[model samples]
Target: MKHPSVIIFFLLSYVCCFAQEHTNKEVDSLYKEDQFYAGITYNLLGKIPEDVSQSGFSLGFHLGFIKDMPINKNRNVAIGLGLGFSANSYNQNLLINKDDLGNTTYTVIEDTGTYTKNKFSSHLIELPIEFRWRTSTATDYNFWRIYTGFKLGYVLTHRTKYIGDLGKIRYSNIEDFNNFQYGLTLSAGYNTWNLFLYYALNPIFSSDARLNGSEIDMNAVKIGLIFYIL
Candidate 1:
């Protein structure tokens, strides 16, 4: 038989090794989820002028990274703050032109048949803040999620193009556009397919942009799908 001290040493060594392995498992369980995302949306105009109407497909593309901060032990509830980029286009009958004095003019095209292409596009850098809740665990890949948030964006570049009887009019960086845009956003769904919506809280154009002596206050609404990745 082995000496009594030798057996005690072996038993002590086994206990220490088991305890260390258990501690490593606990550390590994503290994990985070859903750090990256990408989405596409069908863009719409709201609160538009009486004569203005959408003609073509207006779409938006978005992608971003979010910092997720879980508040509870289960990690099912979290706050997310992210930086994103978005490119959006609005196709409508409202005309954007420049006068002789280099001033901007806004007009509604009564006859849609006159124009082949008329739209304005905007590129923005966005900040999104969300309150996130989900049926997610550290290791679960498929779960339900509901994320509601507010998004603020600053226009990086803007352009207007018209091709028709007007003989191809194009302009860039119109001063009438509001450089800062903000909105409310919601995203919810199960697993890979998620529904997303954004409703603008402010107008796309500044108050100086007027139509028929009234401020042309038009908001934006976006509906689409958003996908999240680990």
Candidate 2:
């Protein structure tokens, strides 16, 4: 769900029901200096034109390491910094193109069996920074947590593929693809299964990219399950 109410509801419920129980000493022991995170998310295009729509399921994966730095004596709150890899695929009816003049464009086309397996995928090297909070003791493996952060990603690879018609065709590392991306992220869970959300602040294509003479700007939104090991 795109609505923020869903996120607020869970967070508020968790805090109200459990946050008051932790003692100062117990909270102090909650933070771990190092953590590993993994996530599997469903991807969506947040602002695509009504005429253009997703055709198939889009899946995304993220794996990262974070080093936590306690900011208070209680250690229930901390800041995290880390590096990782991210990759995602989108199967949609929109197709990427270049006009005769070399201007990049996104065109909505019919799938009539002329082409199959149409999709676009990208991989990135990323740095994540987070502010974390939790209710836990040193020995507690299960805890309530709210982690919010931003991640900056540099494009590592990009590909577009189509199989059918004239034959299999693929484009790799298209010049019009955005090389840099940054997004806001949030994760909250009682234990290993966290609800994760990522909203990209940048568009998928360069500023100059257009469709039918209109600028084409599409940002990504992801929501799903995330796990953590500390």
Candidate 3:
């Protein structure tokens, strides 16, 4: 599903719920404060970019999900709290920094490098509850849906191991999350299904081996489909 589609669904759901609220006064009055939703969501994890630019994506993969949420749908907004599990990895051998003190000297070493292959696998339990503002109750005129929210995730395991070329490779010792992860997400979509993209603004690792702050910067862009089975 695309980013825009997610927003459209949110808007459509919001409008439908609101309209129903007025006609079904008894149901609305007796309505439970929340709704329970569980479904499978597939995600594409792009290559961890080296620079601040999010434009380049050389490779990506799929992730699985299991979500359980208590939702509240109202006129202006609705909130969804979900728990999901995903497995994703990316590899690049050519960009491994090799000069030891390479960045400090500003000089290129003479064939003094090796292309290292490694993968970072994550086991994340995510809780993302988003709030959306609907412009209208009618889907025909409601072509816009805007959302902003936060997601809290705990890292169960983070592993980075080297592969290929037996004698020439050395492995890295990864640091675990200090405790938990807290980040923000923004998206827009339309049409009752999922037409939206999600952006994560958080570092994947809680600690870096370099001791500089974040050992690696993890910014992700995921576009997918979202709908309900039940």
Full-model lDDT for every candidate? 0.84, 0.77, 0.41
Q: Where does model 1 exceed 4 Å of error?
A: 1-27
- Regions more than 4 Å wrong, model 2: 1-34, 98-105
Q: Put the candidates in TM-score order, highest first.
A: 1, 2, 3
Q: Give lDDT tens digits, candidate 3, residues 71-151.
A: 334344555555654333434332222247532111111221332344444455677667755443322233355656776
190-230 per-residue lDDT for model 2 (tens digits): 86568999999999888677777776688889998777765
**Backbone clash tally for model 2?**
0
Deviation from native of the Cα of residue 88 in model 1, angstroms: 0.2
Between candidates 2 and 3, the one scoring higher on TM-score is 2
Question: For residues 1-230, could you state the per-residue lDDT of candidate 1 as single tens digits?
Answer: 02422443454344334423312234336666667777778899999888789998987877778898888999999999999888888899999999999999999999999989999998899999999999987656678999999999999989999999989999999999999999999999987678999999999999999999999889989999887765
Candidate 1 whole-model C-alpha lDDT, 0 to 1:
0.84
Which is the winner by lDDT between candidate 2 and candidate 3? 2
**Which ten residues in a row are the worst by lDDT in model 2?**
1-10
What is the C-alpha RMSD, rounded to one decimal, of candidate 3?
9.6
